[model samples]
Every structure is written in structure tokens, then in C-alpha cells.
Target: MSAEEVHNRISMLRAERGVSRKDLAAALGVHYQTIGYLERGEYSPSLFLALRIAEYFGVPVEVVFSLRPFPRLGSEVVK
Candidate 1:
């Protein structure tokens, strides 16, 4: 099947969790470069991989990836 453009919050979530790509990749049982590829949108992860990542980050899969661009945090807030 054709892969969809799955935008994700991988970088942001990893940063917030103080996780390096290598650490996350090791936890996900993938090569460290796979994390880079995912972060750069150069590769789309399989559903199982995506779910595993979501579990690692303590968030739902939808919170980690979306088919459409997600709105920026606080973008809905007024000054």
C-alpha cells in the first residue's frame, strides 16, 4: 500500500522527554538512523512501529502522528 504523509510530533515529544534519537531507536528496536528518517519525514513507519512509539512516549497513536498538519500549541490561545 502507498504510504500516506504522516506528520508527527516525534522530535518535540522526544525533546520534552529528554530522549536522544539513539535512545529512542534502541527502545524501539530500530536503527538510530531510523529515528532520524522518521523525524525528517523521509520514512513512514509501519502501524505496529507507530503504536510502539506512541506507547514509549506515553501518548495515544493519534497524538504522535496525524495525516494532516496539527495546529501549533497555544495557537488557539489569545494574548
Candidate 2:
């Protein structure tokens, strides 16, 4: 099976809001590392957390997360 395609382009949103990680963490009731991980795309949040993040940013969950087809992996695949 292919892995799910995930992208966490949150840095731009953070910058646009002018809020620090610590602040968001507090608002989200998670550790600062959680925010760090999320922003880095190293973590995929649960539905609740995704909703919290979207609410924090005043954006829709669809804006923060999306599903796309995973790229095939093999020599036959095109770049």
C-alpha cells in the first residue's frame, strides 16, 4: 500500500498571524514540540487537533489538510 500524501505548510500561516509557537501551543493545549512537529510536516494531527488548528488560524480544516494520491515508487515512475 502507498503512504498517505501529507503536507504541512504552516509556517506561512504562522508568520501571517504573527503568533509564536508557544502561544499556539498553549491555545491548542499541546506541547510546543507538537506545534514544531506539525509545522515541519513531521506529524499528522488527529481530527480534533486538526480542527483546533483550523479554528486557531480561523481557517477551514480543508485549507490546513488535504488528501492527494500517493506517488508511485519504482524505477518506472516518472519524476
Deviation in Å, model 1, residue 55 alpha carbon: 0.5
Candidate number with greatest lDDT: 1
**TM-score (all chains, Cα) for each model:** 0.91, 0.76
Model 1 alpha-carbon drift over 4 Å, by segment:
1-3
RMSD of each: 2.6, 6.6
* Candidate 1 lDDT by residue in tens digits, 1-79: 2357889999999999999999999999999999999998889999999999999999999999998888888988954
Q: Per-residue lDDT of 1-79 in model 2, one digit per residue for the tens?
A: 2375566546667888898999999998999999899877778899899988888899987777766522333646554
User: lDDT, candidate 2, residue 73?
Assistant: 39
How does model 1 score by TM-score? 0.91
Provide the lowest-lDDT 10-residue window in model 2: 68-77
